[model samples]
Target: MEVDYVVVGGGSAGCVLAARLSEDPAVQVALLEAGPPDASVLIHCPAGLALLAKNGQANWGFETVPQPGLGGRRGYQPRGKVLGGSSSVNAMIYARGHHADYDAWAAEGNAGWSWDEVLPYFRKAEHNERGADAWHGSGGPLNVMDLRSPHRFGPIFVQAGMQAGFRENRDFNGAEQEGVGLFQVTHRNGERCSAAKAYLTPHLARPNLHVVTGAHATRILFDGRRAVGVAYRHERTIQSVKARREVLLSAGALLSPQLLMLSGVGPAAHLQEHGIPVLHDLPGVGRNLHDHIDVVQVVEAPHLTDLFGLSPRGIANALKGIVEWRRHRSGLLTTNFAEAGGFIKSDPAEPLPDLQLHFVIGKLMDHGRQTVWGHGYSCHVCLLRPRSRGSLLLASKDPLAPPRIDPNFLADADDLRRLVRGFRVMRDILAQPVLAAFRGREQAASAAAVSDEQVERFIRGHADTIYHPVGSCRMGSGPLDVVDAQLRVHGMQGLRVVDASIMPSIVGGNTNAPVIMIGEKAADLVKAAREPVHATREAVAA
Candidate 1:
């Protein structure tokens, strides 16, 4: 099949690209997804994320190479493989990170990405339930709303923060990002409004747009230095689709770089080692990978039956929640586990909040993969901006194999020190009188760790990613940069990467919202570039 644009990956950015580009009915767009469609009931219901987290269905479930910083433990990296990407299986928290994050991008020689410039695109993509404001928008595709069934413990968590001397912030994406409060989610009437739901689903019927699921893109087909099309696998058969104008790669932070390397567009030496012919000698294709290193503090509270767990009471409550949700789209089923969270600085002297906290109404260990039987709650404290960096390399020449991921967690001594301070601060909040009623016996490992040395050991033993990875295909003008200010791959034509991968640095909050905003702005950039050519064509015809 052939189209004006062939978008590889029907994730958050790809969905946005397909929808926005197809707006001009004159243009034809095709979106290819490696996983199944987002048709599962588990995908639409907000609480279904927990079940999705435990299983590999619709999840890449990628594991990182054992890191020396974490005492040689392999970290779990779960990315959404289905449509809407990770946004379909995430906590649904809507955050844009600190304003300085975008400014940092602009400072790195990437024009049109500063906070002041990108804020409009953010507003253009949002349809907040609270309506328009100086910082938010209304009547947009992506819906952002307050949780309909927020857990009672959410307020308690905030009160504990206040008691611990932190102010309460009702909106994290507002004028400031500090303080604690319940998170606004990407929901509409209690149901998940994933990127696919907002940007792609409603546009699927457009005659100019085509969406194909279960298509694993193996490589980008290039003609000379320009991306001409995409070659993928569908139903055990190899298939190729041509792109008349451009091939937009929105395969995400990890896969986007992997695909580039697989197509022989990455580090030439690495590609040659895997017996692949080099097409482009971009050394930065898979470099500069980093993520938020997080550690959780668990407290067992069997008395709190409302908390999610494996207990009989918890199971019964879940069943009841399902019924209530199916009937009215309300009740416990609407809960996004990390319902309440905040951004704070480990030390008051820090210019910005360097730490982010997520209060889960359940025992979450190992990204909720390991089962801990009990009714309890957990708090996650992550270093928002780690100095540590890592890289992604091809494991083999085969495109089907997973890439070798090394996050190099805590490679910097300062990252560990800040985490220690963040842990102590979280422990203090949990100890506040307001939470004394809900708090229970601290997890044995955490309770035993009192001294700074003990805390450092604990972090090395248990710290992992909070699931935000970026910079693999960063946008800048540096020798190590992959894409430019327009998001086009450096030294490559008819290609652009519109996802978290382009972020020069990890943001200080959840990445989903920022990625969606990238999609919004990228769509405009793509269209603006095409306008001049279209004008030239019209003039020639006249």
Candidate 2:
């Protein structure tokens, strides 16, 4: 099949790209997704996040090679394979990240990507519940809603935060993002609103758009130095689709860079080693991997108000919740797994919070529902900025095989220091009198005495990723950069990566909103590039 644009992966970014690019009505866009349709009930229910992982129905369930830094234990990295990808199964918290994070991208030779430039796209894609303003939008495709029925502990958590010296900000995505408060979730009505639901669902009927599920993009088909199309596998057969204008890759951090490498667009020697002849000699295609490392500090709770204690009776009561949500558009089912969270900077001098905290009223552990017999109060702390770097490499030439993900977490001394500070921050928050009422006892046993060295040891033993992976295909203008500011591969034409992979650095918070924004902005850039000069002049004049 041939089209104007062939978008690989229908995740948060790809969904937005396909939706926006097809808006012209004259252009043809095809979105290819390897996973099945995203109709799973678990995806729509806020409390169902635990069931999605390891179920094989919604997730890729990729496991990483045992990291030496993480004590030779292989980590489980779950990426959603269904229509909306990770956004479908995520906690649904909406965060745009700190301003400095985007400004740093522009400073690192990626012009036109400063926070000032990116914020408009963020607004343009959001339909925030808090109403429209300079910082938010009310008519955008993506839905951002204030929590309708917060957990009983939500307000107490905020008050406790204030007692601990953290200011309270109603909107984290507003003018300034510092302080403790209720999180805004990606929901429309009372259902989980993923990018697919917000962007692609509304545009699927367009004759200009074609969405193909269960089709996995295998490799980029190159015509000399230009990317012409893609080869994919579906129903045990390999098929090829050509893009007349461009082959945009939104395959995400793990797969996009890995696919580029598989297609010989990565490290020269590594591609040759796998018998894949080199197409582009970009040494940084799969380098500079980064992700937030988090340690879940669990404490036993006095009351059964936590997620675990909800009875069979509670689930039965939830039927009333379902009816209430279906009728009034408000209930317990609408809850985003995280009811409360905030940001804090370890160094007081920093402009914005460097630590991201997620407060959960559930006993979510072992990647959510691997085991759930215990009742607890859990607050996870993830260092927003880590000095650690990792890499993504082709495990084999086969596209079916998952890539080797070495986050190399805690390899840097600074990352260890930051995580230690994050743990302390969580401790301080729990120490507040309001939270002290619920605090029971420490569940994760202390490794040693409470010295700095002992804390470092505990961190090394306990630290794991917060699931925010980026920088595998770092965007910039230097020899080490793989893609440019417009997300075009550094030396390749008609090929662009518009996903988490192209992030020069990971954002401060969850990646769903930022990844969706990348898709929106990418469509604009692609549209602008293909527009005729006279037409552009006419539009500007109009």
Strongest candidate by TM-score = 1
Model 1, range 324-365, lDDT digits (tens) per residue?
Answer: 999999999999999998999999999999999999999998
Candidate 2, after superposition: displacement of residue 528 in Å?
1.1
Over the stretch 1-542, how does candidate 2's per-residue lDDT look in tens digits? Answer: 77888999999999999999999898989999999888877887765675675465588877777877677777778888989988998889999998888999999878888999998899999999889998998899999998878778777878888999999988898888889999999988777899999998888899999899999989888767777778899999988777778889998999999889988898899999899989888999889998888877776763554354355655565677678776876777777757898988877887768898888776556666455544566788888988889899998998998889888888888888878877887888877999887656666554242777777677677677777889898899878789998889988888899999899988888998999989989999999899321111111111
Error of model 1, residue 443, in angstroms: 0.9
At residue 456, give the lDDT of candidate 1. 95
Give all TM-scores, in the order shown: 0.97, 0.94
**CA lDDT for candidate 2:** 0.83
Best by lDDT: 1
Q: Model 2 Cα displacement at 252 (Å)?
A: 0.3
